[model samples]
Target: MPRKDTCKRRRIVLYAVRSAEFTTSDDRQTVYIVETDHDTYLFILFTSEVERNLYLYAREEEVSDEVKENFTNLANELSFDPEAITYLPKVPVPRRLPCLAPCDCPGDAPRVPSPPRRARPPDGLPRRPYGARSAQRQGLLFRQLFEAESFTYTYLLADPKTKEAVLIDPVLETAQRDTTLVKQLGLNLLYAVNTHCHTDHITGTGLLKQLLPGCRSVISRDSGASADILIREGHALKFGAFALEARSTPGHTDGCRTYVLNDQSMAFTGDALLIRGCGRTDFQQGSPEALYRSVREKIFTLPGDCLIYLAHDYTGQTISTMEEERTLNPRLTLPLEAFVELMNNSNLPKPKQIDFAVPANLKCGVQDVAV
Candidate 1:
């Protein structure tokens, strides 16, 4: 099994009104405490200095000034920037306080539980007839594949009637697994499509071409990458009767393209957009300014109900919707300058595979295939 972060020394505490439950004291103002791996501390969620003062104004006799001082110092040590904090709606549970929000707490902290999920299409919705005359009657055969090493998501979309299929952002290590599944499903794999030239993991397009003859590779022409087919803005990549409308969204990389299904039911946003985050613009011709525009204009313009599929998700999320992302994406929701500052200052660790992945991915990840 792939190793995942189980627990990272994080906890939550809520200060409630004297009348509310979960209060630690009986004095009109009460204190809440949380325990972590290292020590016990008073925890409160605050966005600005003003809010911090509100949290600090506990009943002085009940909670000592010394304890409040320590809390203030800890919050400062964590560099509580207003831009970094994301506030969530307070959920109303029976006895426990609903999760409030998450912050950039010290250490590999666990995230606070999110509010109850919104309604979505049912998982077992019966597939429509393959060749039905009505556009609404056609069903898409979709599969989401994962490569644990790089935390990448590979999507396989196909037409149920013709079995014509496309694989998006496939990784080199899992080429055989994808090939086996395609064969098992009797799919005629038509295209191995890449949304952009990746840095973290080598592309599986080349291997797929070799494994499944006649399968061509696809990428954005601006990506400066070699491929069997180069697509551009407004291009349509058709397989069977359905097509993917290519929209240039180049903030993550010069070549990033978001592929929307013809009917606008779904969009494959490469590294450009993520579950509650977005692609890093620290390298690979990354421009926070350009990415902000791309998302706000090209992606946000889609229908609110359009389903969003992404290239990678670290948090085990498989899908999201336009309405959810437009409203909830922490990074993108920021104003342009704030978004730029946040992206530029994210001191993320370098990807482990960049050195080899970039060179091979430029050639459609073909160089890594065993001859």
Candidate 2:
């Protein structure tokens, strides 16, 4: 399969020709059929202007034998064909809905369309046998690391092409483990970025810099922590061809920032938002009002399909979607006033590590790096 970014630009173009017509056009256009739980989509790849013009002018055909056979087998298995094609299942064209496009092929075949529709699974067959990483995330190397002592999550994101990477919210005790993993993976660690200074645990950004030469520590300027790089909203931390766009979300801490990938497919939301709950706004300049707005405005505004990766997950849950959190978050669903009241009234005890952790994190977790 092609890279995820490449596939996103592909369009489903229907042509009247079949196996016999595969020889008509040049090698500039190729057809692909994708099957998902919701629907089946036909994709067209036009490599040159001449091929696109030919396809638009007369809807000529050209498909490799391997692809042609695959399409035929898939169509037969799914009971799909030109005449039976319908527009009910449409692939969203960005945000707009394109119902159909005119088909200029020889026969009276149905026009091409896209959408999201429910399709029943075959008898005794599961829609998806297991959960797996999406093909759309193909070119990106993403790892979710955990520190059991603090129940914290550290993220390692890298561009597979260049092996340039950044670690998000590394814990002090686990810094060596993370560093070893990076070296074993042959990656060039570029940045150890903290979303904010933490009260429960020290940040490994400072230790990571010591362990991995050339690695810089990044933190929001508002965090008031000592770091090699201080960033603000709209700052882009890049590694090779990819970048993490920072969005300041300062309710949990004055320095909390959410790092969203350039493609908007995933986000590293540290303490700002969680699977179903949110961070406590009881200390470190924490404010319910600011948090509510931060989550609703900064985090919720991302695409619904964007996956939410958190800095910490107390429960076993590790991931969520923007849509799920927007609709299902218990505290966020309430009116602003009610939400604020609930948060302000909670008398949760101070974290056990606050005294030492806060001071250590303020310096980016270097002095206590003995472990």
Candidate 3:
């Protein structure tokens, strides 16, 4: 007739909490007793917890309410008291020795983690699981975006069809996760393509070349600093029925390229067009006039419904459409006359490495940085 305090069942096992709380946008007072758990797990109780749960829910099979109901009904039939909650198994498990504090050891702190090793995926970049494309579609495959050698958003795009895949931009942290997922998905490397000459993003092209011996490398015209297949503007890369076209949008950088997956209505603008804005033009042989014309004359001219896929999101917002950007991006909407005037009057500070980076990026990011 009675039930145990199932209220104690917390989604997370945190050590402690005063209570749980949820807030409506602009309304922070509607706090509630979200489940409580152990202390170490408190980190999972923040707003980030919801994001983590959403990610996990996408990856794992969800527990259905039917199964839960059946389990409860069986327990009730067995006359199990729901009012009492007991967790102690009363069985001894192998105990692990606690690590002593390093006060007695000076060398402990010196053991810094070594740099992430390079990923050699035959010859291409590795892709990971990126969740659903839309509300009604299943997650075709996984995608992992990483900061590659040149600080590029290296991507691993998988083909759920043949379980074969390609890597877009694999930075060096990408190797660990890429190899793990590739093996997990039983996929093979097909090709590695660079949207264009990348400077800020880490370049894993070299690393991928080393790992994947036979994978083909696709680079926009004169992309690979050393050497590779030149992807001229409007080149169509066909994969079975799937194809991607290289749309040259030269303004942010001379060789900046955007790859459009026409079937998907999405164009991956490496650094040309971001989610809500455009990349800064203070770096790498940048000319504000050139950037203005590129965004106005080239990218903005695309179908208003074109979905823009950004490589960087410093502002946190993800993918958006050209229509949204047209209505929202101030930089893109500025009149030509005003744009030139603004640039002339703009006193924007130079990029961190303007002293040495600008010239380097123009040369396809072959910079000689002295560390």
Candidate 4:
């Protein structure tokens, strides 16, 4: 299993409080709090005329060392004196004031016995799986596969009547599993397509071709990656009676494309537009401005109800819709200037596998040696 920190995506929201009152006292102090979707924290600073000391306290769950380090760095950038910034040990949970009740016997009455906890599943029992399709339209065969190591999602789409299929953003590590599923479903795998030249994981196109002799590799002509078929903007990748219209939605990378189903039912947005977020634009030929324009003009132009599939999601989200993203995506929903600032200010670390993934992906997942 991956480390807890690595498995979860990092989302830190920092708030600087000019003055905050502590529960124990009415004294106002300069405090900075770091919050995430799950937890809240307080950064307490002790300042004198000439020196300052900083301490961190969690208001809810325990904060990870990685989070502390990140917030500490952020604090320094915000001009906070960090000469003695330290993460204090977990503090005791503060007790609430006793409830006053005249009817209830003796103010404490054993605190009204807590409810019994539900029994958990047996150890041998398998946990619920991920990637199950939440909904499917008539005559469409769709499956979503997740690769945990890279947090990448690969999609398989086929026509129920003809069994002709196309796969999108398949990862090298999950190639065999994907092909096996295709075979088991008795589908005719026609094309292995990539939305862009990914920097985090190698594409499974080459491997799929080697396994399914008739399968062809597809990618954008401008992606600069070798493939059996190099498609340009407006090209239709058809299988059976259905087709996907390749719309040039470059920004996260120069070659990024959003493939919309011919009927406008759905779109597979690569790293260009994610669920409530977007791909980082610090590397791999990324451009914040270009991404903003691409999303606004190309993707946002799709039908409001059109389902939007993503290439990767680290926050356990499976899918979203065009309308949802247009209105709720924190990054894309912002004004152009604010969006650019958000992207530019994102201090994200480079993908750990970028060095090996990029070269192998450039060759469509044909590696020199086996793992």
Candidate 5:
């Protein structure tokens, strides 16, 4: 399958075929059907006076053997390269509701109930509802903020009803932008939290506390960083009716923590895990073995549907799910021995801002006074 970003741009378009008709059953034209484990594709080679166009049709699941044979024969006849045919990218199609007929029965007549509609976020964003699980309930407001220099992601989660909010992994450079959004949303900033002491950028917790007087700075007790509140494993940060349980998940750093929502709906996984990859465990008290265990025991143990929000995503990925990371993340999905070897041999360059950022972050983003 193509990458998500690539698939997002996949669209089927039919070129100018002034007058065209389905010639599959007639066997008078070149038509082929290819089958794969997850999907079936139908390819039609249309010959025109000026050019030849390939029209492809994609369907979910298996296709008949006869259709496969037909496609193979057509390909052989045209001397087409087998490698030239490719599966069309998967696209999300809207679910079609069953047809409903007007009821003309007595009041006591039995009626068929309609299927439950999926709930959506207030901003009309799509929600994932698989199998028996229902969509995410309303009242949760989520926004993703970015710091370009560090490629860090700062998340703002709020309980709209209570106007209580929290900012996660905020960078100092983006403090004003984050505060502006908080004020614009009329939200009461309750906490400016860090998943860990970051080496790539200074924490915005101090600046945010200065700007939002009611907000407190928070970090893990083991982080060796000054904060208004130092949390440990099993500690719950509560605001309004929501609570985030802090789960010790040190690997990239000794104090790395994964904050999980009370509902187990999502988790903030700092640098412990990333989209398709993970953080380098070569410095900053980094340990590949410990990180591997942390991911498997702390993060991977969550429900498959639980969203995994990362502190930094170099590939522009905003969020992923436990299920996706479990099956798709190359680093986390590897065997323990393989993962350790990979991490040790990564040989990545050190962060450019580590020298300055680490010291400032140790003091909660405060610079030392001149002697």
Candidate 6:
């Protein structure tokens, strides 16, 4: 296409309220407003000189009374200069996506093993079933419920049609409870992910793979740990209902990973980005500088409205917004130079029994607990 035609595209972000279009190129995002559907274009002018020039030229021809009034009001109120481009290029679209796996019993199979079921109390309590669905399907949601044992939190995510789901970083001590939860929910156990193999967590995931057939185990590449599926910074998986994009965050562990779910302003920051600060950097292969870049570049750069759910928060806080973390986190608020100093200086205690706990975590959940 000719430069003139490409320039003619006149990228306009239609409305300022309830919607916004930020044209991004070369890793830089610019926020702008498009007031009209027609081809008329205007760039925000910060300086008085540019403002006058825009006003004079925009009203060069005989303009309608309403348009003239709008031009005057907008021009006067405009404070920041926004770049104008004609014929903004269309965003690249994702290609044909595959389906999610479901837990449908085979038709010819004899008495479908009535999987273990969770019995809810008849008492008048609202049964809240946590639902997860694959990005492939927009409206379909798979619902499940499991009591988070000790400090563990249960998460359900699946591909669109396969309706398959995976449990991430669950507690081991309560294996039967979670299995019952999965069976009651009618979800097939495809794979379980231990974001970073940690002992206090992941015991159940290992146990489930054996108790439930075909459920593979996955972990990060840098983690230096083994798994059925070894994923790294660039790996992605399509579960039956949802697809997850893996992000390598080194501070928590050399292999600590974060998963962005459904682009719905929600990311499962295994332990990298927590509500207050990121995971502690004193652990194996943990580096403060690497953690800083992970949060600043990979996590914080996203929309402020995105939701971040941390895996372990002994304090009982469930969730937090990216905006809050950006503004208030002590580690994030400080300069990177200062952060590195703190990561080195802070006198935080070591995780309670990692040496004994971690070796067992690598086993997926069947191994017995150490005294």
Alpha-carbon RMSD to native, per candidate: 19.8, 12.9, 20.4, 21.0, 19.7, 19.0
Model 4 misplaced regions, further than 4 Å: 1-136, 365-371
Model 5 misplaced regions, further than 4 Å: 1-136, 365-371
> Residue-wise lDDT of candidate 6 within 18-77, one digit each (tens)?
122222221112222324545343332211100112212233354465655665565444
Model 4 residue 67 CA deviation in Å: 67
TM-score, cand. 4: 0.63
lDDT of 3 by residue, 20-85 (tens): 222222111111111213111010111120111100101112324453343345334322322221
Q: Which residue segments of model 6 deviate by more than 4 Å?
A: 1-150, 159-161, 364-371
- Clash number for model 1? 0
Per-residue lDDT of candidate 1, residues 304-330 (tens digit): 556788999888887887777998999
- How big is the RMSD of model 4? 21.0
Name the weakest run of 10 consecutive residues (lDDT summed) in model 5.
5-14
> What's the number of clashes in each of the models?
0, 6, 41, 0, 1, 28
Considering TM-score, which of the candidate structures 2 and 5 is the better prediction for this target?
A: 2
* Candidate 4 lDDT trough over 10 residues, lowest sum: 4-13
What's the lDDT for residue 269 in model 5?
94
Candidate 5 has a TM-score of 0.64
Tell me the TM-score of each prediction against the true structure. 0.64, 0.67, 0.55, 0.63, 0.64, 0.61
Candidate 2: deviation at residue 211, Å? 1.2
The residue-by-residue lDDT of candidate 2 on 13-76, one tens digit each, is 3332221112111123334444444434454322221112111111114334454455456444
Query: Which is the winner by TM-score between candidate 1 and candidate 3?
Result: 1
lDDT of 4 by residue, 1-371 (tens): 21111101111111222122211111113344455566555555543211234666542236666776777696665345444456555443212211111123222111211112234446775221112332243357889889998899999999878999999999888989998999999999999999999988888888888888798888888777778888899999898767899999888988898999775657999999999988788887889999999999999976555678999998899888776798888888888999888889989888888897777777763433343
Q: Pick the candidate with the highest TM-score.
A: 2
